[model samples]
Target chain A: MFYVPVSSSGGDTVNTGAAITPAQYVQHHLEHLTLNLRTFRVGDLQEAQGFWVLNLDTFLVSLILGIGLVVFLRFVAVRMREVPGGLQNFVEIMVGFVDKSISEVYHGKSKLLAPMSLIIFMWVFLMNAMDLLPVDLLWRILDLFGVTYFKNVPTADPNVTFAMSLAVFFLIIFYNIKIKKFHLAKEMLTVPFGGYLFPLNLVFRLIEECVKPLSLALRLFGNMFAGELVFILIALLPWWGQGLPGGIWAIFHILVITLQAFIFMMLTVVYLSMAHDTH
Target chain B: MGINATLIGQFITFAILVWFTMKYVWPPITQAMHDREKKIAAGLEAAERSKRELEMAERKAMSIIRDAKQQATHIIDEASRHSVLLVEEAKQQAKEEGARMIELAQHEISREVTQAKEVLKTQLATLVVAGAEKVIQRHLDASAHMALLDELVAEI
Candidate 1:
């Protein structure tokens, strides 16, 4: 193992480097705090190791943010006033934005859509917003607690993204079954290519159904992952030179983060609305 | 990074969050927003209703004043007509009384003149009879002229 040394202001020494090279730094930042659940190993870092592994960092971070969202919204709900101010006002604007988005897309009446969209937008946004925090600061803090691998943004992780998209996937199936009933099967077999080409129609219909969630998951994961990569790359530069590019990227990234969350939510509404529509 | 248990874990978390939000968070806030909207609408409707009522009341007051003015004019017209009728009746009574007084004065003068004429006639007859008796006694034989003097007295 190689190590780098740091000179303290008190003339003391601290070995701060877990990685000796720039490539290792990026790898280290990219790594997730994982657990191989099949073997029951908590801090497994080996790339080609386990069949059943859990990205504990992604799980924990997303869970905490999700809970934080629920708690904060609960607080706002409990103390909701006719004349809102502060956090309540901010939360209301977020809720209202999600409501407006849902109303725009899903014309069918479901009480679930608005709040579900709200959670997806805010939860994903909060997760993506974590990228703005200095990457090394959190790692340095975790280092003191003897934790080596961590990835802060859950949306960057494909598992988390698929998890949310799959939920929307289930909702799509549910609405199709609910609204179309027996006709859903008939439409799947006959509609686009016609009854004569049932096999081709089935293939195309399956592809269409699968594409909804796949695109949703991939779009969010790709954007956030790329953003995290850029931040890690910026972190590779010397401490003094990192500020300009980092600041500029962080500013531009605000739009990306918000836009990606919005896209994910909007797609969810569109998919569900399609499910509700008759052929 | 790849497929893992975190997928299921996140799905669970997502479910929990959605459930929690739907149960506790969504209903009350949405209810409050809708309630506020209904309140505003009701308030506006009430304001409109009151405004219409006020206009109707004002119109009613104006009409009432108009009716009162019309009634007052009618009463004034009736009173003036009654006063004119009373004046005409007084003038007619005065004219009738003047005519009656003139007729009574004419009747009294006619009665007085008739009475005076009858007294004058009786006095003239007596004087004529006395003058005839003196002339007869002086100029002729008394027995022969007696019969003619009696006849003339009878004629007178």
Candidate 2:
């Protein structure tokens, strides 16, 4: 079952806009390009889909956001002075903050942690911050080119979110395997907590590993998706009435975007720090 | 409802972007940060060296000034000493010259006095002689009378 918001219904204020039911609008926004060409699976992964499945919109926005971040950082880095000025100062402050956090977590392995954490923080922050942009802005821009179905926030997509989380997860698992070796995995599984508690420990370990990606993906996806929905809902209001609430929400969302990005970045560093440690 | 095809495209785009960023963009950016730090350190070191050099030069200049003052004082002292010695030598030579001039004047005065005395004596003798000659002449007249006087004396 899908949840539909009340704002989407009877909210078409523009004369040029076509009338859309709440379900239609939400479905239109939620739909993704999938691998299953013959059988369309909603959330089931058992049905092995086609090989060339792709989410064109997700790729575009992710590429753009990533490139934008890279360029922006490069610009800042190029212009950075020991005595920083303007945006360079801001970038330095951010780098300093991240470096300090990394030092706190993996003080010994900061050589690896610093750069990794910085990229994760900056790249993901930019992705999350993209949600703050008016949802309709990109749609309107793309609508000119006859492309109507587009979601601006790449992090909202489970696939993209899961991919980022999985990258971290793999790194954790890889480090564990590399550090503990494969022999330890067998021992960890065979070790007895007591009599029947052995299975419990294994289950707990599995759950713990599973939860990393789920939580990482879900947290970012849920937040950005919710933020996007709020923007959509706000846009539905009459233009004159929309201005006040939209302006206020936008103002408030600036903090939300920056904070969420910072939190994601911090968590990423923390997770990586955890990965470098022996469980 | 059909799924949007663009979502997959965006995902691909984002993945490539992220990968490229990690590969290319990050290295140079980090390098740039390090390079900037090095430049700042170098600049600071250079400034410090320059300041130290300036201080050294100032000290050297002060030392030279001190040495010049000492030399100037020594020269003045030597000049004063030579002047004093010259004055003493001149005084001794002047005293000797004055003594020699006084002795020569005394000797000349004595000689003149002796000559004057001798000449006066000679003049006295000449006057006496002249008187005697005159008397003799008067007596010759008396010679005739003398014969008569002699005969008278003989008869006495």
Candidate 3:
């Protein structure tokens, strides 16, 4: 569920031939600029060493983006006015929209969900917006710093997607345990089946509960990864020919990014709402 | 790519982000909006109150004007009636004064005639006495016959 196989290796132009093939290009783009926490050095286009290793690119991009957006939102929130203007107005509209969407799907009143959804929507959308930049842009820049491998889109990384989804999953479990208490145990044993099939019900409940986060993560990762992949593939085309299809995909991808962010938020709300509900 | 500490790192970042948002970002905008809504409602209510007060003041002013106009007309009628009564009283006093003066004049004229007639009669008596004296060719003492002459004058 969490593995992304390194499709190709030696992605740093070690080819005996002149120009790198398309496959190597895609592989190079997919590689993570990993930091081997044990070895105290960054990876050089190699496989991640062990569980202790961190994908510095994915972590930093997400952390920076997350903190940046949050900081900006908090900045705007600090300066909020009754008659909003500029960024304040935009932020209000966005926050109001998120609040409304959450209220619509999540009938329960939890303080955490609305803000969580807001950040999730905004942060994921920003991460997805990274796809719109030239596929080689950040790599070329980070490469100039002598960094070998980097994946710019954090959501394209399963670890980032799963990390966010698992956070929501933990919240779901926490709320289910907190609010439902003993009834949660009974329901998990008896749901979607009679008491005679309580074991089956438990298994089904486990699968069902696990699937929420699984689908949430995979859906976003799949869309963003495929999108990033296509852009990489489009970059494979001759420079003059790439514009038409690239432009089309980028335009269409605007919708995809927004919709993915929105869907991620909505599903989180729904899942948490389900967790909160007695059923 | 595989699961590693990046998931934990991202999880921490996501947690802190959501935490920061819940703490710092959410309340103020909504609060500002709520405060604005309350202010707008208050403004509308104040306008409504002022309009109502204005209507009432206008109505009161109109009523006061009506009352003052009626009072003014009432005073005008009273003033005219009082002046007419004063003129009639003055005319009546003038007529009575003229009649009194005429009556006073008649009394004075009669008194004067009576006094003149008595003086003539006395003068005639004195002349008659003087003629009688001359015809009789007697010279009586005029002073001695005073009583008889007075009586004769009186009779005349």
Between candidates 1 and 3, the lDDT winner: 3
Clash pairs of candidate 1?
none
* iRMS, all models: 1.1, 4.7, 1.0
Residue B21 error, candidate 2, Å: 2.8
Model 2, B1-156: lDDT tens digits are 122343345445545655655565556556666778899899999999999999999999999999999999999999999999999999989888888878887787888777776675565445544554575577766565656545643443
Which of the numbered candidates is closest to the native, going by highest lDDT? Answer: 3
Per-residue lDDT over A1-279 for candidate 2, one digit per residue giving the tens place of the 0 to 100 score: 222222221222322344665556655565442334345442222332444445556666677667777778777765655566888767766777876776776744434446556766777777777777776677657656545356777777766766666666776777667666865465457644643566777886788778987787778778777777777777666667878888888788778767766776677677666656654
Q: Please report, as a residue range, the 10-residue window in candidate 3 chain A with the lowest summed lDDT.
A: A1-10
Q: Regarding DockQ, does 1 or 2 come out ahead?
A: 1
TM-score of chain B of each: 0.57, 0.60, 0.70
Candidate achieving higher DockQ, 2 or 3: 3
lDDT for B119 in candidate 2 is 73
Interface DockQ of each model: 0.52, 0.15, 0.60
List fnat, each candidate.
0.76, 0.22, 0.89
DockQ of 3: 0.60
Model 1 chain A: lowest-lDDT 10 consecutive positions? A4-13
Off by over 4 Å in 1: A1-19, A38-40, A82-86, B73-156
| Model 1's TM-score against the true structure | 0.77
Model 3: per-residue lDDT, tens digit, B71-99? Answer: 99999999999999999999999999989
